[model samples]
Target: MAEKNYYDILGVKKDASDADIKKRYRKLVRQFHPDVSDDPDADNKIAEINNAYETIRDKDKRAEYDAMLDNPFASQGGAGGFGGQSAGGQSGFRWEDMKDQFGDGEAFGGGGFRFDDIFSAFGRGARGSAGAQSSGTSGGFDQFGGGFGAQDSKGQDQHAEISVDLASVYSGDDYSIKLNVPVRKPNGSVDYENKTLKIKIPKGITDGKQIRLAGQGAAGHGGGKNGDLFLKVKITHSDNIRLEGADVYQTLNIAPWEAALGDKVNVTTPTGTLGVSIPKNSKSGSNLRLKGKGIPAKHTGDLYLTLNIVNPEVNTDEAKQAYEQLKQAFADTSIHR
Candidate 1:
């Protein structure tokens, strides 16, 4: 196959900024990743892009490539020629003679250049003396000497979802949670290990919020810092109560007589059951507000009770006869409706 231009593959200019290069790289990688793409040649294209990027992204390699473009044999023969063969393969030159001519110094007065040093820097292989093959094989950026300090004993971070009842968020408390954390051995092998961690749920924590646990993530290599654990909180619905903002709400079923004639009724709250007085002639759907009776927070919210009128189920003959008598008494009264 013909050599491909890295800049063309990435759709970037030769003089593109690092940021632009990275942006283009991410876009192309996402598009051509074999696992995520159905394109028949995606894998081959991705590999080509990788190689192209490796050559152009490096300052030294880019300069060398540019020089080669200017003079195909510049490094091989003319103008301070290094006795090395041009990648074009005209003929091999004496590398030692070029080294002597250039002197054992950093590239152009910068860091002194050593062929072995450059190879090692780029993660090719450990430097060997002249004529010795470097032992390490190249593996993309992972081979770069100063990349990640060590391999992760555990491959990747694990995630989990945690459900909290609405009441718990309203009135914060300590919770004990169990999680399966990936543990790695010294040899960089991983296994799922169950761990119990106690977390404090802050008062007024909202639903769908997240909590981070430091150093509770997957194990790192060579005793490196562990990854972080993220806990996503979901509020569960309750049968007895509904939550709105910071307030608690519930429907109170009351007998028709109790609603019409003022009466004391029992209502349940997070704290405890309390007696509530209903006004006389109260209508169904009338809301009663209890101040500071809702969530336990720094600024407490109120609880609301919506009254619901309920009629007793009459199944006996006597109950039916009494209902008939009541209907007859109110037969002419439009107020009953």
Candidate 2:
């Protein structure tokens, strides 16, 4: 197969800036990510994007790739590549065919042949001599004739969920969040590492929304580009308030006397405590709306106060007398029955 151009794969110019490369990479990732895309080649496309982004995102690796693109035969692991036989060697052996003949043919005890093992089989002196030629020159081919390009420094971007309190969502504050991201090495092994980041919570941010942080993810390989961090916001229930869209709701308890007569009572809102007027003859379960006092947004919503009437203790002589007087006043009324 022919080598692919990293810049073309990422839809960027050869001289594209790091930020431009990242933007294009993210757009492609979203389109080709396996979890979201059902394209037959989505996985392959993602890998290609990752590889290309890794190569071009770094100055050194990109320069090396550009050099290799100018001259394909400049890399180590010779021109025929990967599974071909070395020229002028005895036994008419191909690396893949040799792997089939010997159970230990693969690199590092696998069925495949390792480049280093192939070099060792040819003798260390021969390998050293090959390296000496390729080491100093910009386009000199190595023993394997494959490119010895630098890896990407910025690793793959990872996604995770972050939990935020309702207060934080309502008030819009900065929160410290910790996440465990998976790091994969070039050899295909994976490990988890913990990272703490401070994220700014935007006001009126709904649950299940996603926030993106650039270059705050895993380290890249071979000096490639670093990955991005995605934070999915989740809000827990609050004790004082209930969230409904951009609106907030709470219940306020009022004394029987206060409910019957008009009064100004202190009510708590998400922003602060404020006094609200209850009209005379205000019945239990009355809802009072405090305008523009709810969650912060371009245009604020109202805070609702549902009134719950509470009866005073009748243990006191004055309270008992007042109740008796009220009862006597309604003695002729059949409404109680």
RMSD of each: 11.1, 16.1
lDDT of 2 at 311: 86
Which residue segments of model 1 deviate by more than 4 Å?
A: 1-158, 165-171, 297-299, 335-337
| Candidate 1 lDDT tens digits, 202-222 | 777655667888788867544
The CA lDDT of each predicted structure is: 0.60, 0.63
Worst 10-residue lDDT window for candidate 1 reads 79-88
Tens digits of lDDT, candidate 2, 184-279: 555422346787788899988876778889877776653445678888887776564677766777888898778878899887666677988988
Candidate 1 overall Cα lDDT vs. reference? 0.60
Lowest summed lDDT window (length 10), candidate 2 = 79-88
